[model samples]
Target chain A: MNHRVLLLALLLLALPSWAVIETYQFDTDLQRQRYNAFIEELRCPKCQNQNLSGSDSAISQDLRRQLHAMIMAGKSDIEITQYMVDRYGDFILYRPRFNAATAVLWLLPVGLLLGGLAIWALMASRRTRRVPIQPLDDHDRAALDSLLSDEEKPSERSGGNS
Target chain B: MSRIKLFLPLIIFLVLVAIFFGVQRRVQTGDYSPTALPSALLNKPFPEFSLPTLQGESLSRAELPKQWLLVNVWATWCPTCHYEHPFLVELAERGVPILGVDYKDRREPALKWLAEKGDPYFATVFDEQGTLGLDLGVTGAPETYLVDAEGIVRFRYQGALDQKVWDEQFAPMLSSLEEASP
Candidate 1:
């Protein structure tokens, strides 16, 4: 009996997750899918963090109703999104449209990656490069001769040690 | 080049500091609020609506006068509405045309509220179902919209209206709007 009560309590806890229960009849499965997708993507204006599907705020519920009615009336996705944008501004959209303001947001990561790649290529190319061999210069040769003369040849030194 | 590279981090940190301080200043001054959305209907015509007045009379676009006015969204349930009531009353006394939208409010409580606190609105829109409020893109009660003489939505403010807000934000805009009109 305790186990059953606990199970029932757990089931009741799950009930709140399915907030705002309103039956929306769609002509086809695709239409229903579109409705789900739209609710997920559309932000609740009142509850800024929650989407239409997650929020039970008055505005969110109303928007869900409107979305369902629009779908039932066979409005295209663009038309429906545009309708939302017209009323709630771009803030309603979870993914903001590409515009002058949002261009920086979308392009910054890609730009940074390309910049990093260019620097990496430059560093890699630098690391792989070998200084072109120069024939011994007169000054270098003179210095080299002085240093060598100061020490016995390795062959002679090794032979003496043996 | 290496010396300049050394300062790159400092430069980036300075830029970040500048950006943060700029945002902080705006937030401190009450100029920036995350929840307040810029109205999509700015510079657009006021949305058309046919609804009943508090007096049981029909009101529509035809009834809106060809004069600049304020549309205030309020409800008896909203605490801020009570806070701003006196200021609205003052504005109305100063000959500012004010229209009230009783958003998602019961008729009895709303009527009682008006009776207890003097009604400042020239005409009160009975939006019990929140149809007009939804059309106006009202996120919550105590939102106000400034409509120009041409029926254009000039501005939408999301908060309780006060004297400071009036002088600092709305008054300058109102004067400019008045000057622009023939």
Candidate 2:
């Protein structure tokens, strides 16, 4: 029984060393998810087809890590994305920022909407004020009616002519 | 009538001109920027994943040495993956160690593809669950990663590899990494 106690004490002495705590900079789940969202929204400029967060490309991974670090360093999502934009171009954004370089991108749908409205207005106005075609006079109408009757009288006249 | 009708074509021409300018402006905005993105995970440590080979043996991250190694995450289902296969095969022949992670693929199809086409990897990791892919930030297949031997990612290339990219970007980076390593 004494020998068993000594063995148990030795085991207990070793147990404390086995338990280790690892601390990550992104301690909160919210911060980590935010970082993920930010990366997901950004485009991988190198691979134009992929978003930076979704791409496992080394560059993307690096960018994610960089963003994570930046978050830990207390940088906001806008700041991080802008930093990438400044280094790369507007291509880094899956949804690009509105500036001189990308103003048209942002305003295109609005422009299309306004242009459509203008066209609709123009068409409505044009239709409302259309130049009406005048009806034929009595003499012309009588001639047209007679021509129509003459054309339909072909079978009736065949027997008479014979 | 002659004076008024003379300006009809001019009015039409101005309208056409306005439409043309609007379209041009739209085009400029819709066009995505042609600039390449730098690797986002630069200087960040890689995620942990243990992938088994087709031969059924698992490989760990520790197996890869401390140098610039390209990790190709792909699957047979990915059409773009096939497009980049030949480029990878050629790179493999040139002594580039391609670490392939077969993402969410069946063992048989992957084996068949590797058998029909020439194998291009020094070592392959089978990620059937795609958990590793998520950890690596992969959205789809046919993505490539450039990781230093320390397992820190250096660069990333998305989509398929073309000759021009192989020549311009990867070749130079490969040479430099080789020179920098022991």
Candidate 3:
């Protein structure tokens, strides 16, 4: 009778605390793929250096599922990204969107490239002017011929001896 | 005219050098974006491995109840591990149980580091051979995995953590989970 009471207590203790896992399934292939891409491109803010897709950080996972649900509910890519940006700021996007605040982020590279080309053209032209010269004058040609003939001198002596 | 002809190649060489340096400078000044892998592994199950703790006690994914967990793979040899240690401790105090895998470290030193630094994990697993680390796609020390309650591998971080990241990326997502589970 005591053993039966102990067994009943153990079963009651185990019953209420069981975790309820919520599983969400995607209905369409296109929505799933888009959700996958969006999460992969967005950086995981907590881990900071990894994207939501690549990171196994808990936050990244939650964000991925959230993005997945949003996509399934028919949110556009722009809307999804904007919603994240509105909440988290523009730093979430791996390729940060263009705006007045991020114009530098977008345009700085192009400006630098153009500036580099300009500097290159200037330096290239300057170098074209400063390079030292070497001339193939008549004297140099004569010297070269004498040097070549000088090598034959030893052979000529050997030929004479033969 | 012949002198000019001789200098043409020399001029071309200098021009090439200038172009190279110019390109390098441009590269240095631009934004450094994070290059991350695709989402093929999202909601996938965590890799399986059971190993002894630094204390010689056994530890594995099965030991913990199903919840969101941060599995940090680190070693004493890793310099970046030190950089992220404090953040891990804070995460632990906040009720996020961290499972520390002391990869490639001697038992004595691993225990000492934890003792001095304040133990951040509910348990610490030893992966001295790095076999378990490789199975989870750990490229180096200081990698983290976020596993969901169902034991699904939810996310992965390849490097150190910081405040800006914790605030912008990690905190907001966690809010939703707290709402969902509570």
Candidate with top DockQ is 1
RMSD of 1: 5.1
Encode model 3's per-residue lDDT on A12-105: one tens digit a residue.
Answer: 9888555322345788888768876886789776565788766775445556666776888898988888766643456678898788878998
Whole-model lDDT values for every prediction: 0.90, 0.76, 0.74
> How close is every model to the real structure, measured as TM-score?
0.82, 0.46, 0.44
Per-model DockQ against the true two-chain complex: 0.69, 0.04, 0.02
Quote the positional error of residue B51 for candidate 1 in Å.
Answer: 0.7
Task: Give the least accurate 10-residue stretch of model 3 chain A, judged by summed lDDT.
Answer: A16-25
Measured with C-alpha atoms, the lDDT of residue A101 in candidate 1 is 60
For candidate 2, the lDDT comes to 0.76
Candidate 3 CAPRI assessment class: incorrect
Candidates' chain B TM-scores in the order shown: 0.94, 0.76, 0.76
Candidate whose TM-score is highest = 1
Better of 1 and 3 by TM-score: 1
lDDT of 1: 0.90
Score chain B of candidate 1 by TM-score: 0.94
The CA lDDT at A115 in model 2 is 99
Give the 10-residue window scoring lowest on summed lDDT in candidate 2 chain A. A16-25
Q: Least accurate stretch of 10 residues (summed lDDT) in model 2 chain B?
A: B30-39
